[model samples]
Target: MFCYKFPCGEFQTLTKMTETGITFDPPVYEQRYCAAIQILEDSRWSNQIKKVVEFGCAEMRFFQLMRRIEKIENIVLVDIDEPLLRKNSTSVDPLVSDYIRRREGPLSVQILQGSVADSSEELRDTDAVIALELIEHVYDDVLSKIPSNIFGFMQPKLVVFSTPNSDYNVIFTRFNPLLPNGFRHDDHKFEWTREEFKSWCLGIVEKYPNYMFSLMGVGNPPKDLESVGHVSQIALFVRKDFLEMQLENPLVTTPNLDDESTPYKLIHSVDYPFYVDTRTEKEKLWTEVQIELQRFKKMANLSENELDSYQETYKVPIGLILDRLHHVGATKEALLELLQENNLKIDDECVIIEDCDEESEGSDLYELSERLSQDVILTDQEHEEECWDLNQES
Candidate 1:
């Protein structure tokens, strides 16, 4: 996992700002946790997030979660406030940092002190844009600025926005009920009802003709539906063409259930790592073991092949291989045995079996593996002829 540059010193300086000496508000964490849960509820939705842009992220906790997503390429944090942005430059809460830090990668955090309209060139290509609890803060005079601020400028594939319902704002008054008529935000220009939000989203869709809008946390209710109110509506606006293609004729579905003609009928891969190795009978068993072991290596980012070798020598469970790797500490022995188990010919003296280029001899295994993974060049025919039995294919 890549690390976020969270300024510990700056957080120490801002510690006094916490009312109860807790730097992060529990409600903020709750909201973030809930959003993550919501994202996970829809597997397709969770998979769709690649590059993200978050607007009005006070401390960028939401963006931090975006960074955690497995395939995420970039995360851009945008906020109008300078201090809040500065805080994202460091630790927002010391206690929560460690738990969440390992999950975060190096985010492409860009702090812009203006609305989403003024986003930089890098932000315009974001795959998704999130504006949670921010639309209400726009002044009534600048209400039109909302669509003009985001539309072609951000050009996000999906837009997610949430705000409080004006009609159901009474409950939060005592806790935060200072606003007139029980509205959530004191400076909020307008609080929207369910219909009002849909209408607003429709207007946005009209402007961005390719967009499709739907209300989350509404029709498809969850188990804890009683606590949820109409006041808090989460809106998902996806590109209309994409939504139509996905919903109407999803290419990725259960395999051979009915339509056998579809190209991507299987929800998961059958012979994903390699296709050619699955066809032949002689190498089938060996290939299966190799594929599984390769998956383990890739997932764990193991530089040495010791775990692979140990797994082969002992014929142990995947867990045992992992344990031995951890116990023995990753060395060439572990990986070589794992590879040998998968039918690779191994000699005691030939532990360093990799046909290293003369240039990378002194380099570490990790660095060599990285280079080898990218170098797809076919080896010299003479080397292949001289190495071992031509029919071995080990």
Candidate 2:
């Protein structure tokens, strides 16, 4: 998701130039997207792809574009930036919700906040992995590890990666004289020529003998130059072992979540069932409840006065308050019991749980339960312990 940003003055100048009909055309950006779709279309295994993971899914612009393809049931967007991840997650939630509500195929979207260089358990069992215009931003050491992580560790059936063609810098330098050396972006650590890209692909193929790759270029080069010297280069890797295994045991399936054999931690997830409208009032209430749960967890406790203050500040309707609490992991039975213990009438639809005794010393049972229910750390720890145990045994 990381990308170069021009300084304020330079950006303003660029903007002014563009507004005056002098555009800085980056053909590689659009061409890469087209190439990725075309590659998927050409693949014999395209229909078999139930899930696709996108590395460096900045702003999820490509995800929004690609999710329309009917064959993909799930898309996992991974990025290193948490704020961008959260923003994209918020942006896509309503779209996903609408898709689910309309029954337009089961399409699940997960926003993972993690590094692509690291082998993620969440990447396991996916059909394909995509990284477009991403590799040039990282140093050689990290770039070398990405292929192994994708092909050897995740072991997806297919991988589609694209990077800038350094050879095209000569053409680029013509457009902007300031970039004399022809670095596409200020943040790019290294851009590869066609031969360099091919060598790296060959190295990956050699490292994982079971996987093979194909190279292609996007965008048109000068009539004198070959297609390999185009604006962008793409590599698609297919796992031979996986294809053979699939043919042998066609009905065999991998777990959707991490299991004994696939011991990778599910670090972050946002799963939406194809029935809920996330824009509903109920959903808003649930969101508020979740926020309150986090705040209480951070403080480790909430005094009755603070609780009263929160209740007053955020005036949730009485009729749907209980239902909202239940939606956010508070058990209906426990809520009913709480009502009874306080000598309250459960049938009274107008009743809100606002009466907090000022003398009460402990966190509310509902808040405690909600906080405990979010066992993300515990789940990850258990996975790590299990992986360690398996390693020891091996």
Candidate 3:
């Protein structure tokens, strides 16, 4: 076994060797990283993300990026290949070490050799779970079990999943004419079309209603082929129950470190089990929204006699905005700024309300509802139909 320590006290250990030493490379799929980062940056719960477990942390390319994010405090890297895990655990990558030193608090790094099909108790209570470019490698039987284990058993607040878009293989074949008919890599069991991927995710939601998902593409599809697919498709799943509970009590306990019977073996110990809390920046904005809603009745133009009559009427639009604030991954600050901007514009207008017609009121409410749907929920109906075109061609 080999062990290495970084300047920041982060320790890594390698317990296995391959016939040929593993080599680390920078990630070739830059778009996937960009998508993942955008999800994290846009999240209202960004400050709540601290512990992340990566299912297939090959070469630690994406892992390096996760470590650099200011909120992440603990990371568990898992891979099916023991030798590859060993190589990455002991790697002297400058980017990895630099991220460790720059972290604001103690950072724990755990490396494990395992398959996603197998459940690990250590993974429970994590904030965010990630599996990038990994689902394609698993057979369908095994792939079907992953969501249940990750969402139902581990129950992380957020899950970032990505898989290759088989519809985009033609673009790849242009560079490698001799590429196999249906596979990109020798080990890839299947590359799913966008529809198949959506079906699989929808099934997960059906089984686990506590979770909700949004899908996006990583790379740019050709203008003509835009309907077909992008290079990769990603799904971000959020657990609604956890989101509500986290806002009330942000501190969560780490897994029991004393339980040495865990499948994961630690090479270096940074710290044992302890409690950590999400950053309060976003939560503060949520509180501000709550407080501001109470004051809305006072700000709107209403006479002493009219205040009671219009109070509930004025709440309809504000309620729509508040509902959006609850569901959107956008930061509280951004949502608050948007509300303030729209309020300023409304203040500039001179309006005299003679009567509140129920029909007109409903129409106005529907407009706010439509805007919320467009902004908070992400769906590409065109891409879904285009991705299905590959099935017809086959």
Candidate 4:
């Protein structure tokens, strides 16, 4: 097999190789990488990406993912391998070369032959930049150049990138651990834990005054058990100007309780798996659900411990922003009515509901009926009974 130069300047041969002597062909990592790309496509960031550039995209997976959100107007694929670019001409994945070719008229695909270190000027004027599974391959001497070139030159609105969690590789690769810095992998110049990744990202963001960074851990346990706090880290770097403009009161408010069942309707209208894909992307939604539920509980003035049961029993507001979207400017009656309709009872200090206890089956309804009676609304017993029936049950 042809031994490729490692990022550490060492040459290593793969244990297994095809007749063509191609080493380091990992289909598993590739598929998981593609799954990460899929996760990005389903997130709120998808709406912001209209033009895309994939540095070391390797097989055009990120490009394909971007297209699912919107038609890509321009694409630039950069790699050091010219033969790969030539073969990309007929790559089964459309974005490689065929996508630009088949764009129905005068369109051109820009393929640059160079490494990211040498191609900073080329990474220009794009809506989003993706550097997936590319940083691991950069030689240590050239590593600093990677981010500086991209941020210093391109200044794209957003950047989505992923790298190996150092712990993941160490645990899986079983390299020396006693050393302060840990052992090096066969071909990796550096492997980073989530924290190291964040520090580097923060340093890069500091260099550019207009950028802000958010870190998202991308993978699940088996891949990274060390980062149990959050899963894999998926870093998102967005320009501060764009973020401020977008968040200028995104017009989100809490839901009104008594808007003719519309609040209930809207909440229920949310599709099952209120996220994208459950199979591979479940962890992303799980993190989102946890984060949002906490925000909702806080907005409702419920303690963290209270939400332990709340999240299990019912759909809690994912975040106050989302809650604001649901109830902003809503009348107090409408808000209270929605809470009651959902079997959620709110008091001055606590927002609560009966547990899934069989004994409390009709108790909330009975209490709600009494409150309505006191208000001189739903005075008819039969109508109250119907209202209970209409509102209760999922």
lDDT of model 2, residue 84: 72
* Model 3, residue pairs in steric clash: none
Which sections of candidate 2 miss by over 4 Å? Answer: 1-26, 96-104, 178-182, 226-228, 241-394
TM-score of each: 0.51, 0.55, 0.55, 0.46
Task: Tell me how far the alpha carbon of residue 10 in candidate 2 is from the true structure, in angstroms, after superposition.
Answer: 37
Candidate 1 segments whose C-alpha is farther than 4 A from its true place = 1-29, 36-48, 92-107, 172-182, 218-228, 244-394
lDDT string for model 1 (64-174, tens) is 345435455456566666666665555222222233223233333344554554434445556677787788887764566566545555556667788876544443342
| Cα lDDT over the full model 1 | 0.48
Quote the RMSD, in angstroms, for model 4. 20.8
Model 3 CA deviation exceeding 4 Å by range: 1-28, 92-102, 242-262, 265-394
lDDT of 3 by residue, 66-124 (tens): 65566677788888887776665654133322432234565677777777866677677
On the 0 to 100 scale, the lDDT of residue 58 in model 3 is 77
Model 3: lDDT of residue 11: 15
Question: What is the C-alpha lDDT profile of model 4 across 1-394, one tens digit per residue?
Answer: 0111112232121223234422232333443454445534644455565556777855544443343333345566766666666565343233222322233222224555666665333455666777776787778767877765566556677777777666655443433343344434455667777778878887886666567776654334432243442223466676665654433222112222222211100000000111223443333332333333344433444654554544333334223323544423433454444446555555543444433432575443334434444434423543454334323321
Residue 211 error, candidate 2, Å: 1.3
Q: Candidate 4: global Cα-lDDT?
A: 0.48
Q: Which has the higher TM-score value, candidate number 2 or candidate number 4?
A: 2
